[model samples]
Target: MSAYRPEFEAALRLFARASEAMKARGFPAPILVGGGAVELYSNSAVTTGDFDIVTPRQEEFEGELKQLGFTKPVGLGHTPLGWVHPELRLGFEIVSATVLNGMADRDRLVLIDLGEDGEVAIISVEDMIADRMGQYASGTAPEMLEQARQLFILHGDADLDYMDRRIRHESGGDYGVADLKA
Candidate 1:
């Protein structure tokens, strides 16, 4: 199976540029999260319609994104500023924190180049799955449960114990260790 998707490529390219620009300005690279992170970690087994980004440095990061041609904000006045790529027609939502399966800290981030000009910061596969599971439990994005299951089936190496803890925590025991195994 080929993990090739034009949307994924374009999003990564934009993210890499934004990351590099932020670093050039002495700001930390934001961690890629939500569906976009799932798409990358799944090798494109799943794709996202929008990019969900997390960083404490919202102002600085938005400035970098603006430099990369993401000028028009698209959301209805939200904290997580939304933008549409003028050329690619892709969308980006930048937030300061991860509401689902939040990382312990930025130290958990890993940088991957994906053969691109600059590397992108991403959460671990375990964290990404837990994030999906959190979404599932919330009843807001039940589709994430399927995304989580697909990612687990595709990767086959995520930390089960860690994933279980996150699922149980986020689901408040409504989902348990058995749920993770399933």
Candidate 2:
């Protein structure tokens, strides 16, 4: 039997527990952002501790995580090598403030299952790519050039042109993919 992907399992456990707790008190599931959602959409990223979820306005969920026993895990240190986004240390970036509220619509977001555990919120793959390109290139990671390569190679058919454009426009270095080569 296949074992569980630890990174996914751990993140899912955190997300699902939070979702359940929030619903017990009544709040919408948080919108999943970052690499795992990207892989879920583009079908590329390896299992990683790089999952990041965001709510349009991160209020209720932040309170819920506190209630659910997640006490804002501070960064222990930088993540060791051979992992996903080699920068930004893994863990929740739960925000308890109202930022970017009333800007983007809630309808465009897609829902992906975190197993029978329940649903997880996410933005569009195109949007994820666009967001990655926007300001947090590689989510401020220097080693994410590898993920760009995989995304372009595996999901090339899904959004080759968009990925190509984004990589060239945003990613600061070579992706090692021939078609994506500048």
Q: For model 2, how many clashes?
A: 1
Candidate 2 per-residue lDDT over residues 66-161, each given as its tens digit: 564554433565332212212233456643122123323356577656665666666555445544544335566644545444554555454555
> What is candidate 1's TM-score against the reference?
0.86
lDDT: worst 10-residue window of model 2 = 80-89
RMSD of candidate 1 to the truth, in angstroms, is: 2.9
Q: Clashing residue pairs, candidate 2?
A: 32-121
For each candidate in turn, the TM-score is: 0.86, 0.58
Question: Tens digits of per-residue lDDT for model 1 on 1-182?
Answer: 14658767877888988988787778777888887888887788787777888877887887787888886653665334577777776678875555343434456577887564588898877777777787788899978888888878876766678777766776766775466557
Model 1 Cα shift for residue 36 (angstroms)? 0.4
Best by TM-score: 1
The 10-residue segment with the lowest total lDDT in model 1: 97-106
Per-model root-mean-square deviation over C-alphas: 2.9, 6.9
| Per-model lDDT | 0.74, 0.51
